[model samples]
Target chain A: MGELRLMKGNEALAEAAVRAGSDGYFGYPITPQSEVIEYLMAEKPFERTGMVVLQAESEVAAINMLYGGGGTGKKVMTSSSSPGISLMQEGLSYMAGAEIPCIVANIVRGGPGLGDIQPAQSDYFQSVKGGGHGDYRLPVLAPASVQEMSDFVPISYDLAFKYRTPVLIVSDGLIGQMMEKVELFDQMPRITDKEINEKYPWATNGKPKGKERRILTSLDLDPHKLEKHNFHLQDKYKQIEANEVRYELIDCDDAEYIIVAYGSSSRISQKAIQLARAEGIKVGILRLITLWPFPKKPIDELVIKGIKGFLAVEMSAGQMVEDVKLTVRERTKVEHFGRYGGVIHSPEEVLEALKTKIIGG
Target chain B: MSEIAIQDIIKPENLVYEKTKLMTDKTLSYCPGCGHGTTHRLIMEVIEELGQENETIGVAPVGCSVLAYEFMNVDMQEAAHGRAPAVATAIKRLWPKKVVFTYQGDGDLAAIGTAETIHACNRGEQIVIVFINNGIYGMTGGQMAPTTLPGMKTATSPYGRDIATMGNPLKITELVAQLPGTYYVTRHSVHTAAAARKAKRAIKKAFQNQLDGKPGLSFVEVVSNCNSGWKMEPVQSNIWMEENMFPYYELGDIKVDGKLLSK
Candidate 1:
């Protein structure tokens, strides 16, 4: 274990960014996630790690700044809530189109509009699916705990640079505001231009002598060329789907039913599974870690092992259930139970929903 | 006519001027008689004159000149439509020593990216902004621009632009000049040889301000002609622009050294 410290999830994320050697963070203030920028400003990572921290005029400017920094092959990140993330969709599409690498953390609050400043998982569809206009994909990581909030910063950056794709951390108000003991990782030195050039020859750092100028752009005017680029992106997504699906299974073996959940819902489901098992119900929990490349293979294998039903617990009006239903493909019944508009479901509620929807119905 | 030897013409002493090394050999994608070619050449010439090719980073806007990276032999990042200032802001902040500039068109700078343009200038970001005002969208096929003159015909404004409902054209260069953080704000043109020389000087001064580590924004707006979009011969478009556009968008310095030039 590394240094053990009690910190808020948002603070832990900021600390993790510093330790992970992020070169820049540009963000605007939004509820349930304002602590991210607050912590960065207090820490002054600029003096300590030479990281550039800027409070942009809006989420629009913040994300575009990420595009600029990421285009130069620099490790950059931004954090926002639902409404703020909505403003960033345009820049996200551009980054995806240009194949730039950066991390975005969405500390989700309830919304179709500026709903409320409470935890909600409603943004799952927007983040996991393409939120912006275009045929594109980003690895969406759901952190269920304050520790993973800290841990996923570096992991997301690794996955981001590994594939030259944006990686999103799908958190919520609960995880962002809650304080927990976390083992912070050791510092990793910021990546240098030479290292970036070695890995990404397409990075838009200044053109060196004898090297061709590197143009960082997503605009392919010719339809044929654009189509070719789209194909390449699709291939990359397919590979990610094949290799990067991650989840945690608790009491899965010999269980008749499984509860699929993530983030705060995962925490609630853990307790629900305990209560359900005590009531002679053979229930297990499948906690999703990566939501974009939805852990389909494991769920498929679980179904193969004769699991009869799945209960999807969410903080939205059942957004991720569609993905679960698609993966199950009529082999097993999949039901959804959720609390919408900033409301959270408790363990008792989840257990009753499982018995009523999955086990009984 | 007196016969001159080929060798004499090729001699260094006889050569008056040559194209700058800052331009790549790739053919420019601008349409025939388009001002973008002249503007692009002037910028490259400025970069060459200052010897900042290796130390400069250009942010290319999403317009006809989106492929400017192909022509300018320097580091470039193609920004999303109207996001060049935010992009340039980050690049300049990260690498403060690098001379960063954004080349944008009328629709890109004035209409779609108004917020970024204002905030970046307001914040005094040390970057050069080369705004090309053609009064119409060229890449998307002659759509009305925010700078489009009243009663100007465009693909979108078939019956001429109506200021009553369609709104009056926005003068963004004058708008930017109002910001406290701008060190220099000027509007020039590239229609004739004299105008081209003046435009080149403005561009050189803009780049020099960046190299000199000036603490404020430097904006250079070039009132250009879009022959194809304007539905006129290249030469005719120049005549049209000089007659109509120049009067409204007069060539002059709006701000100098963080102070608005007295009218």
Candidate 2:
């Protein structure tokens, strides 16, 4: 344990980035996540750890900056809300195709188009299922607490560098704005250019003598070459699925019904599970941590053990429910219940929907 | 007669010039007689002359020069259409001591990437922007560009450019020169040997400005000719560009030392 501090989730994340030894941060301010850049600016990470922080002209410029800095094998990241995040899809797709390792946080707001500033999980499909043009996937992480919000920064960057892929923290405004106690980790020293050359030999850090120059690009005009590149990307994704699936089971053993949720919805479902158990109804919750390489194996195992049914709780109208149904494959009942357009469901509402639609049905 | 020894006739001092080592062994992908080749050679030669090859990072834009990384022997990042300036800005900021520049064409710089270009210029980022204006899009076929001359016919402007509906050509270099954050801005050409030498000097000054720790951007716009896009013979395209494009986009220094030159 390094230091215990009570801080807002967004501030903790920005501090966590400094501690994680990030090389650069470029972002545009938007509601519900503006504290990220604010904290970085206030802290002056440049003086502390020599970190580079820039307020970009727009979200479009910010993401492209990530492309340039990340191409040089620097650990870079940015945060934005719904509309700003939508502006980043083009750059994200290019980064994914070029296999640049960087982190992005979407403090998701309600949106089909600038719906509201309040917390909503409507971007589930956009983050997990290729939001950009080409066929590429971003490893998405959901932090259920302010502590997890701080913890996921370093973890996501580690996974990003491990796979040479972009990682997303698909958070919501509730977690971003809420304050909680976080035991921050020890500071990590920034990677030197010499070390970067040793570690990421292929990085475009002005080529070394006797080595071939590196060009970070996603454009391959030849049809066969592009196809092969796509195939290689798919293989990497499949490997990620095989190796990295994370979830937490809250009182799941010997349960008759289960609730599937993540982020703030998972917190609500935990309360709902406790209330259901008090009434002599055997219910539990599976809190998904990694939303992209979803915890399908655990769900499949639970299905084999004959769970009665599942209620997918979310702040959106049944986005992740499709993935839940795809995993269950008709072995058990899978239903969805949620709020929409910046509306959050209460624990009582979630329990009532579970009793009426899933368990009682 | 006794055969003169070839080695004695061809001495080391007899050599006039050689290709710069800053250009790589990879053959250029540009079309034959394309101005991109000349422009690429000039920039690389400038980098070589300044001894910044190992310290330089280039951002290559979309359009015909997108494969500049293949020919330029330096670390590079290929940017999306019109995003090169933004990318170069990031790189320069992160490595403030390194030499960084963006190579963009008319469509990439003047049209799609106008916001990035303007903001970067306005911010006074210490980077060079090499803008190649040929009055048409070359990579994606002969389409009307943001710098397309009025009354010029192109793929999209089959009946000749109608300024009433299709808007007049944009003089982007002049627009960028008005920004306070630009240290040097100039327009040059490469049709003749004298013009090519002048263009090379301009590019060298742009890079040297960065080394001198100048506090603003240096933009060098090279008025080029796209023969295939213009649907003319290579020589004829040169003649047409000199007759038409040169008159509209008159070459010379537009700004010097952060001051716009008087017309």
TM-score of chain B of each: 0.97, 0.96
Q: What TM-score does each of the candidates earn?
A: 0.97, 0.98
Residue B75 in model 2: lDDT: 90
lDDT score at residue A184, model 2, on the 0-100 scale: 96
Error of 1 at A227 (Å): 2.0
For model 1 chain A, where is the 10-residue window of minimal lDDT?
A: A203-212
For candidate 1, the lDDT comes to: 0.93
Residues A41-119 of candidate 1: C-alpha lDDT, one tens digit per residue:
9999999999999999999999999999998889999999999999999999999999999999999999889899999
Q: Which docking category, incorrect, acceptable, medium or high, applies to candidate 1? A: medium
Instruction: Give the number of the best model, judged by TM-score.
Output: 2
lDDT of 2 by residue, A159-192 (tens): 9999999999999999999999999999999999
Q: Note the residue pairs that clash in candidate 1.
A: none
Indicate the worst ten consecutive residues by lDDT in candidate 1 chain B: B47-56
